[model samples]
Target: MCVADGGVKTDRLSPAMVDKLTFLRGVGKQFWDLTDARIVNRNITMLRLGTLLLLCGSVFANELTINKIEDAAKAGQFTNIKIGNIQVPAGQTLHLKGLKAGTKIDFVGKVTFGFKQWEGPLIKIEGKGITVTGSPGHVIDCDGKRWWDGKGGNGGTTKPKFFAARLTDSSISNLNVKNLPVHGFSINSCQKLAITGVNIDVSSGDYANGAHNTDGFDVGSSSDIQIKNCNVKNQDDCLAINSGKNILFQGNTCSGGHGISIGSVGARKDNVVQGVIIKDNVVMKSTNGIRVKTVLNAVGSVSDVTFENIKLVDISKVGITVQGNYLNGGPKGEPTGGVPIRDLTIKNVYGNVLPKGTNILVWVKNASNWKFAFRTLWEVKDKIWRRTIKQDSDAQWRGPGQCFADHPQPRATRFTFP
Candidate 1:
């Protein structure tokens, strides 16, 4: 029996039903006093619903049986259907053709990740304004162990991306994705997309082999996108924004990854990323806290960005960085003037390094008048840069904690570059 919102739907019982009801009633009597009255009342409602349904018709009993979600999907029918076990093995993709505009499809069982030679987006939604929600115990499990040689999505025997959502105006939430052979989630060409409350659990393979580039989420070429309240445990950037605008990331937990990043920008043929807000997030034992990166010779511009209220624990590398040339050892590297970044801010941010070194606080080149003021960027400068920390004991600032021994308090700094 399924009771949802005071409506009872049941498997009609006959003499068999009466017998089972009697048996259940006898079982209920044993614990009736201890059970919640509401639950008992619901059970009684279920019994009554069952009795009425049986008398109404025998066909009612057949309605409760499970059916394939893909079957209805094959016919483009949107119904309240329950799928038990569905498999999309390698060499086959489940295509939902001509999707309804506002359809709600729920998966109860595992959406097994297919192992293949090309990229695997086990599930791809090619429609507009749809929602793909997962309940408890439902997983899009990629058998990443088969391909976790540490090279990740970069190279290997064709690891599949776990989930991909394309087009616009969608909300995908409450899903647990695990063991991605390569990158876990990819958002492409989406406008106004919100991905929340999702868990990316790839921490298992970080040490199991040498998990190299297993990024949890990679957002590319989308505008007005927000990803928040999610947990990513992997080897590469917890979230890598390749290209997008007005992208906001907040309230997330990232551990065992390359922290949160923007760019590897201009890697795309024709795309640029701007207007990013990374706020209220926690980074744990990751490589870097908050960063923006661009290739040495790429032509693009990243401007108007902010990283605020981020808490870092045992970060192994730099605290916050903005660099157009990522190949160099530091953000202050000679700028080729390829992709110019401007209007940056790091406000109310705090981080602690785990020994090795905390490199440059903020670095930029090929931009005029950059400011890291907490409140706002009042003036824009050109072709020069300046970095200020609360106090640096040594001119060399040797390696993170060794130099800034007692500066535990949070401080705001600004970088103005020429």
Candidate 2:
């Protein structure tokens, strides 16, 4: 019965398994004190104490129920196999790689993950203070219409990218991911991670639009990340901060997709996306509203960003896209003054767009100390605003009929466009 740091070595429990682990540790201390008790059923008492710790076995070990897929890939690392569920066996990959530190995974009903063509993630949650959860209409389903067929991940068929969480000080919440044959959640190198109320529904890939590149949370090189109250309807970027440092996207709700991004940030020389905080959030029929792509020559440096109280809708093209000649997916050629955006702050952002969208599009080659206080009340409809960097009519009313048109100029050695 040696259960200390080295954990699990069970043998002694048979007094009715020690009275069911003393009534399951008093119902796990009222389910860990209902995690701060807002109490609207607290996820139905955490799914009835995770189905009574999966039918009485997990006081802290032996509850595993991985129905194959190589016994859930050899039960990850097994630090006392506390409480795993994972019901694999439709098409195949349910990896769950190294998990150990304080493990607690769930999902018993609708956990299908078996489609294949290759290059998949299918489901791979690495460890470190892990705690993955699900069961409120439980769904991990990645049938993705048997792999969309619309050139996602480049050219069709090999669709498998479902969920690849590289958690650190983890906490994934009430998840309900769907139709993800392509990108969905690839949060990497997480530290103090807390993704809440997760719900990435690929709106049926918008029907004939065929869900190509379905990204919902592509954070990378994470730090104290906290993606809150999430709910994304994907097609592309709903939250893509490709490098991190104190990131926090709050009260989320993005639709259609290609909103809330912080870079195709410098392709990687230790890519640095600094203290970001996209607050309040809610972007609807998005195409681009709150973006910051930087990739041309690629190096690094996206600093202190803050987009506050944002709420855009129907933005069909550009509501706020800062560019550095991003490639492949738009912004064709010439504008690489090497990733240097600093101290940007856009506030009180309200929204609208669709009469040929384009509320603000700053083509950055380099920026510094920018502050836009979009004083609410906006209903953009081609209120065209473009910046190559030469703003001084007090930054031209800040937006909504904010005029500026001499684009493509910021490179006379950085700062001389007009």
Candidate 3:
């Protein structure tokens, strides 16, 4: 119930929450009588309202420590509930029915181990300014081996995404996510969100099973978000930023995934992603880096994005690519032209490559007025450009203006002079 020392109490539930405890008791007509309050005297109602207000004022008088959730979840008004030092069980979901401001939840132990296609998010928080953090060295073990046969979202075992949805003004940090059944985390409709200092290790899916598409962080329709100081070593896109404004992603380490992308946009359905910055991140041995691809036929505007100071090593394909008219190769290499890309910048990127026949340093199509600056583009055609494309001896083989030449498109050609 309480943990206190030296006149400083750490955690307790609100008294206003305790006042509502009477409502949870006494079933049938009495429950409705307290909840409905249709027949109560107006003066009595005013007195109860005043009492509730006073209780609320006293709720946070000391830090409200909640270790036992079975008792706290029973409270109706979840305003100002501070959850600290709590160990939750498997197959459990904490629902923030109607949370209010100043609600802080601290996760004390490892998350419940899960397998099978259970309806989840292990933890769900709502309302304003909610903070859910795990103790240092905490883990959310999905027991992915149970579901990972390398076919993640492509239909192996039904895998539930970690943190299925996050509302606004929240932070979930300091945890290790190991072997997710499917996608790791999906951030939804949360403004001013910060997901920092977390690790997602789906590498076990790489060899033991066929880990298909285990994307790390999927951001959709949210704003003012920052995902930094994190590591994602999985099979698919490290960060799939769908639709948002003013996003900041930096100081992250990623490998074995699509290196930091924006879009697959306007493909399934289009949305706007504006004012994004992907800088100072290390991408290792990925399929691509600093990419923005749109659906072939979908309609949307993705603009005002900047990628700078990105480092890549042993990557297999495009060093930096922005293409709109994209078509993935199936058994027959079919092309699907569904979406378009626009208004992007990729700068200060230095990397190695396969033969020019294998990797495209920078590729673009079906976008307008995009800029590529300070790119030391590399191609190993004769293994010359891999060293210096602008060498005096290689001038004959270099495209115009060294690396600043327009992409031989009718429109971009006007920007570069012969």
Candidate 4:
């Protein structure tokens, strides 16, 4: 970042510039002798104005590159930045916040963090209308093995969360992250943000005493966000929405973890997940395929969610699960109506769950207006079995926390296709 040092000192000038200025001055003098003195004075003033403008342009460097962390602040001074392989100091974040709008930041080579036992967003980028990108083959090597003791955020060494992206009306893409220490991308308090083609590989932690609670993307307090074309292989949910609305998770792949989920909502400042669409994704070799778990005895609402065109394979746990008894230790043995679910739709979900796992399980209280259309497959004893179950209003739990319907309790039902 170049700035004014007192003033533009022009005591020394290049020989060529001196010659040009001398020639111009001489020409002015000759014209003054032939014409009016006022005309030569006006010409001289214009020449000086041009010289000052040229000098001022040299003081602002519009492009910057830094290899050290301390110099990272210089990036905010330019519209284009290229960050090379650098290691952030322990307990310090590579702060790229509130940059000039339309700034383009490119991550080149490797970005590593100093090992420390602290809560970290290691990297934070917060602003509007910025482009955060990465070069091909560039990797953000978190080297989480140093912190992986299988007790993520519970006990062991206090590990730092990875990226806290609070962007608005911006797009971040093509990031290759590996060995994530804990939660991968915390997309919080953003609007109109798009994240695409960001691949995460935390499978190395699948070993005993390895990573835990490595959620791929955790969204909260946001709206109009789109996460597409991402691949996550970790030990926790591929994507979890604690609170958000109008969110889209599409064209993604999840493996080696608990599958995609919609909260364990409630207990957060914003505990509503609404207008969410999880479409055309593949979840394979995972524990649970798709699930929505609202915390027991908490006050919130999960409404207007649709899971469409999903494909699951080798899901060792429930293929599709929605429960209202979620607790830390385990389910609370019964559904709690505090967090009512409404207007849920599950359509075109076709996949196979191992015999050990159930195909679809819904245990909720005050859940209403559900329409399920499935083309699923599960084999037992070398024979395929398909069953269509639609139960209509066996009993409705219109407890204190049920979402009050205007008329009689709307038909609370479940419909599955054969």
Q: How do these models rank on lDDT, best leading?
A: 4, 2, 1, 3
| Model 4 lDDT per residue over 175-235, tens place | 9999988999999999999999999999999999899999999999999999999999999
TM-score of 4: 0.77
Instruction: Give the distance in Å from residue 90's predicted Cα in candidate 2 to where it truly belongs.
Output: 7.7
Better-scoring candidate (TM-score), 2 or 4: 4
Per-model TM-score on C-alpha atoms: 0.74, 0.34, 0.69, 0.77
Cα miss at 39, model 4 (Å)? 29
lDDT of 3 at 351: 57
Error of model 3, residue 206, in angstroms? 2.3
Model 3 agreement with the true structure over 131-245: per-residue lDDT tens digits: 6665554466666677667666666667666666566777767767787667777877779988898888888777856675778888888899999999999888899888888
Model 4, residue 236: displacement in angstroms?
Answer: 0.3
Q: Model 1, range 1-418, lDDT digits (tens) per residue?
A: 3212223333443333344445444444444445566665667767755654454344233222124344634524552233335667774555454555665445556766456677766666666666666756667677678777766655666666666778477787888878777787788878988889999888778785556677777888789998889999888889888888899999999998889887766646745778999999998888887788877766887777777788877777666666665753444344455777767677766657655545345444576445554333433234434342432332122222232335443332222111
The weakest ten consecutive residues by lDDT in model 3 span 409-418
* Candidate with more favorable, higher TM-score: 3 or 4: 4
Q: Candidate 2 versus the native: TM-score?
A: 0.34
Q: Tell me which residue pairs clash in candidate 4.
A: none
How high is the lDDT of residue 153 in model 2? 89
Candidate 1 at residue 14, lDDT? 31
Model 1 error, position 182 (Å): 0.8
